[model samples]
Target: MAQQATPVRTARLGRTLGQEPTAVSGAVLLLPGGQEVSGRRPSSLLANASVRALGRRLARAGRGEGLAAHVVHYRYRGWNGGDAHLARDATWAVEEVLRRYGDVPVCLAGLDMGGRAALRAGGHEAVNSVVAIAPWLPEDDVAASPEPVKQLAGRQVLIVHGTNDARTDPELSFRFAERAKKANREVCRFEVHADGHGLRQYRDEVTALAADFMMGTLFGRAFARPVRDALAAPPPLGLRMPLAAGFGASLSW
Candidate 1:
């Protein structure tokens, strides 16, 4: 008889960027992007570099508040359709955080495919917020298998997308934000003009916005006016809020 493959198991799948905090008020899990469909090959460093940088920035911004940041190392490198392997890994990371820290709030932050995972995993009880940067939402038959929105209730959700990204349609994320906002008033989205899938053109501004949102949601810091206005405004206006140049430099906190 042929033996089945053994499942991989570990104490943790997260790599802390800095020294692990002895005590944390809150935590952020940074998830990196991957392919649409592929085998269970391990995720690469190239894919994780950007999110790591974002994690470092967030750690610095929330250092005084005792925020612990970790970059989640996914077991597989693809979305793999309904399997949703990456999302499961994100959920596991949340559990790991709870095990180590004991019931502290967590923010799920991801880019590209990682963003989709963050959204999918936001329903976890310990998760207080989610920051999806350049999220990849599949353009399938919406009526048949639309991405879920009901899971986001009572959580602060922020979706950031680049208008010019060709890899993933920005419109799809807007549609998602619209649906999420209907179910949960705290859902908001920001458009990064003239940027691409990687969002490198306005990296500073995007990172700043994400940091602000994460800190505000996890540590109770006041959000910037734009973030507050975006969440409070009605429909189209709030869902399609524009992110301006030098917005990061203007942030007070």
Candidate 2:
């Protein structure tokens, strides 16, 4: 007889980035964007205005859908340029959630570099869905080498990017979504009109979209036709993405 693989237990440890927990069967793990070397996990973890905005919306929506929401503070400070440290942190967060909540389903939402980590880690058995908001990509890169595009197989994935994003190319996100579609039938791409890399204009809408996607996928919460149609819409013409305003000042990472 074939033997079943042993389940490895991860140590439960890390800072809670936001919001109180609830007795729900589902959980959402939110990751904020920042670099590794800045030594600013405190500020970068959940202080970003956009990340907090998303977290608030997710919490509200998750409450309605009976999914507990939590954010993670990385034990380490950086991504290490696509290294495993941040991904390891994410794995730890999921395991902790499972330990506390007892095998509940999980969804991940991340911005920029955090989005990259989520995409790389989304294929894990614990993650039911992933929403990548304006994830960063190396310049002119293909999906095969470092993008982890294929790892999203067998998962529902959503990639939301602004047409005017200057920090990361929206086309790369679109291509990553296409590659993910080859293995996962439930892949979606959303384009925000006239927004920048920070999604400055429609932060609330983006958060709602993520919440809707998470609720729809994990809890059978059906999205309105307008929501579905907008997610499937083509990229609209928009303003150029100006450089972000005072990144370290506003976010401290």
Q: Considering only N, C-alpha and C atoms within 3 Å, which residue pairs clash in candidate 1?
A: none
Candidate 2, lDDT over the whole model? 0.68
User: Across residues 36-100, which tens digit of lDDT does each residue of candidate 1 receive?
Assistant: 88775655678888999899889888887888899888777888989898899999999999998
Q: Write the per-residue lDDT of candidate 2 for residues 1-253, one digit (tens) a residue.
A: 9999966533233333344555667888877676744533446434455666676777776664466776666755567764556677777788888888788888888888778778887877889899889997554445536466667777777788888888888887776666666666667777776789988677656766677778877887775454455334443211112223221122111
Candidate 1: global Cα-lDDT? 0.89
Segments of candidate 1 deviating more than 4 angstroms = 1-11, 140-143
Model 2 steric clash pairs: 36-78
Candidate 2 worst ten-residue window by lDDT = 244-253
Alpha carbon lDDT at 201, candidate 1: 89
Residue 62, model 2: lDDT of 62
Question: For model 2, what is the error of residue 234's alpha carbon versus the real structure, in angstroms, after optimal superposition?
Answer: 12
Backbone clashes in model 2: 1
